[model samples]
Target: MIPKVPSSPQAISKALHSQRSKTFNAFYASIRSLRQTPVEPVDPPSPADNDFILSILRANPSLRDTRSYLASFGVQPQRPKTKSEAQLPEIVIPPPPLPKTSPSLGKVSTEEQHAPSPVIHSILNPVYKRTALVKIQGPFTDVQLDSITRGLAYLEKLGMVSVIVVESDDVPKGDLEERQLLIDEVMRVVTSLERQGSHARPIVGAVVRLGPKPGAEESNTDPTFITPETHIFPSDLTQIRSSLRAGEIPVVAPFALDSFCRSVRVDANDAIAGLACGMVEAGSDNPSEDIDLTPLRLMIINKRGGVPSYARSGYPHLLINLDQEYHHILDTFDPRWKESHPHSFSDLALARTCLQYMPPSSSAIMVSHKSPSSLIGNLITNKPAVSSSLPHALLQGNLRLTPHTPTLLRRGLPIQVIRSLADIDQVKMTTLLEQSFNRKLDQEAFYGRLERTLDFVIIAGDYAGTAIVTNEGNPGSPDPISYLDKFAVLPSHQGDGTVDFLWVALHDESYGLGHPFSANPNGGKGGKGEGRDLVWRSRANNPVNKWYFERSTGHLRMGDWVLFWSDAEKRLKIEETRRGGAGLSFIENWESGRLGNWAQVIPKIPSSWK
Candidate 1:
């Protein structure tokens, strides 16, 4: 018989949590049993059948309606016909007559039930194509724990199996039991939610602990640190693989066993690295021979959120090019902070190390507990929470105020800079521009002017994108004025931060336009004032103006074009004029001259579009 649920939702929730220890195994076993069950001819409902139906209804109250309630038993009730179907002659076949003595809840024939056929469990669930290895930094409050539980359920709904590694960095080394208790508490919360059917798709949580390697030396290193000898692997992944194939989310505690079977505290990041290395070793490198589950994502959930940006205070880098930016990010951390909190450094190292073991396509995400949905959002879109293409300076309101946003780290493509225009591949450039703008390039005219004015070009990933800057200063004009001639990215790379990389390369001092440049109205050479002034013009109706507005200090619209310029003094003058300062006459003269007399040179620049 179905176990009697308490009178209310609160009571039911209480009962589930209270009976967690006793019901945990049985609850998972019931799911396994249901999956293994085979389809058979329909028969009159027995007491056992009634109990099963009642159990399902009580488990998920959302299936209270007749159609949904019947769906649980693999039965679909006839639906009402639409206008099209109603116009046709409808034939109604009543359910087979029930015997007066039959103990049936309702009539359900074999024709009405669409049950699944019997097959081996492996055939039912092949090696999952997408799996996420998640590491959650613990010592969570009740609210945070609940958020994580919901986050895991969201991952399941998105069709990715989650393998969680719980971090014990917050727990003291002397208290090994507390670490285990934390793991147990996590499982308990997951179990209670599963029992209550809080999520549409059920998520079952299982605990798996790492075991020490045979003949490995006893760990004398500190529990908090990750030493080579202290690191332990899931030597035999039989248990982990089995749980995954069975569709269970394995919540692994960082504690492991030694040769003597004593619990050894391991660093959570090391545990993840160990798992990553083990996965690589267990599977073949060749695609045709590989049968292991594909490790698609690595997630780090903690309070600090994604990797911090040393340059931009109170914000995380939206994307990290591990190949290029890893060393830079590591160097940016203060020596004192690294010494005080080693785990912060270790986590950054872990992302780079683990990604090297997985496929080139595999990436990592670091998200905060406050934004659990961001985990699902990032996974679904495979993009950063804040777009890199947006102007960082212009970001305001919540996105700017919120420090803990998700960051995406990948083994991204290298940026290639060609200083001399002679080195650029014209064919690749043509193809990229055509793909990005959906327009044919007038190569002869484009190259004709570029031959004289081209300052430099930055290519990303074999011409997936390019940024072309040129000197647009009038002849005999002493100051060099940098003009963005063309900025285009292949459609495939539009949102993946290729534009940002190209933009960064455009302004990098090593290339040409010196960043942190000084603004001198005199337009003559001296100290920082010698740095080039930057300006660009876009069509008045172009969609990229918002992005331009955010990065540029000032802009003015003309007949069919809008001119944007980056200069500190000019920007302040415009703001001052807007506030009714004495600069209004200067603004009027600037506008009357049409972008400080750029009208003389901008129209002279030949259009590359046919």
Candidate 2:
């Protein structure tokens, strides 16, 4: 007979949280052990407790490797008992070898061309895979279930997956009988192709819990029964990887805590995280292995897959690169961040560098927070050629806020702020401009003008738009000014508030550098008494002038362009010093810094651009 069920999704969420917390705690502990830097302070040893366990540890010797609770706070390994042992220096275990890499994606051997293919590891290659992790999410209707099955079948076909692990713990709030049904349904769909005579081996291993015989709970008075904790069996992962290597899929239904003595409550995420940490530990020990032990990526699929909880626009996702910051990211979500367990999606996405995990070079993971339908094409589509396979395309639009609002961004988009021309790779920046303008920029001249020293570069929407702000004067100059060298919004997003946002953000950013005659102590750092007006130029015929006039203090048509400045000031004695002679040389000198003639390449004043 079936047990009771939760009536709503909220009820299921609560039940899932309670059951998974224990497992998650354990997984978190395991990750902390492998982290390079301690996430939290290690408590000092307790005097009395240390003496008691240290003595036992000293007597039993080999018991050191087995027990979880011993002299955890105080005991150090017992000193050598024999003379030879005492004479030995501290034994240093060398690190494991790194993974072997090929120049590109080349064959291990020409003769075994038909062998199951795995992604080739590329060292120093920015876009190649070092590992891949898969996360299968649930809560599907019959139709969605069919789509999921097809997606899995596609993976089985491409040989992209090493193994697919679906355990009872992964199923939402349900009884043992319901959990079994869930497992069976997943296996049948995944292995449907096997019945069609396909070479794929979808269901090869089933790991179910055993033992903890009745009355075992009565015999054991473990504290865990009161407050459950995460527990991962080494055998589970060992068996899972083995099955995959032998071309079999493993579905693990881990035993609930040994303390519970019941065949209920499974935490799949706890197990998955445990497996990831284990592989990291093992791979660290043997980096130069002929065979890869861990999957390159470990994905966690739930309601929204890998999408963030909130976004300012549609098409939001975060493709996190877990290289150096994985531990930091894990730490935030690891209970220690706020000293609480992660119970919701917001807590899970806890890091603000976007955390980088310890996958080998060129390896990265993408947490897709969208729907399962998105995964369908990514899994089944033919492996497309690299980026160079296509011609370059034009890009425009810019988003840069001084005090970064990290949460406001879409997923998988990485942003960098360049403070100076030296901070950028000129060749690359020039290419970006070429695309934005749809006309090639003079590379040498662009680089030379960049010596004016850019103050900041804000690229948002993944280089779709950018603003190049430059520092334009010597401190001793009569009029020191900050110039907006280039500001372009893509034709597509011209009036979408991108320009307005930048204008306000840049103004505030400049104001914060300190202003002339302002009592706000923090306001006027730009060069007190030197200048307060921020200036730039636009084409005289450009329609954007209408909008510029509305915002600027004043504008003067100087030949091809109109010189615009914030209304905070009239003429500056210092600006006149810019060229000694008249005829708008200051404006003309400012315009000379850019490559490609502005009049020839710039867009006409569209209503929206204004």
* Predictions: Cα RMSD each: 14.8, 23.5
Error of 2 at 494 (Å): 29
Which digits, one per residue and each the tens of the lDDT, describe model 1 over residues 78-104?
356669978999676543222222234
Structural RMSD, model 1: 14.8
* Alpha-carbon runs more than 4 Å astray in model 1: 1-129, 174-235, 255-264, 277-292, 335-342, 359-362, 396-399, 423-431, 434-445, 474-480, 507-533, 537-596
Those runs of model 2 whose alpha carbons end farther than 4 Å from true positions after fitting are 1-132, 141-143, 167-179, 189-235, 254-264, 284-291, 302-315, 318-452, 457-610
Per-candidate local distance difference test = 0.58, 0.38
* The candidate that achieves the highest TM-score relative to the unseen native structure: 1
| Per-residue alpha-carbon lDDT of candidate 2 for residues 297-370, written as tens digits (9 for 90 to 100) | 34344333332211112221222322212232343332332222122333133221112222322122222223
| Steric clash pairs (candidate 1) | none
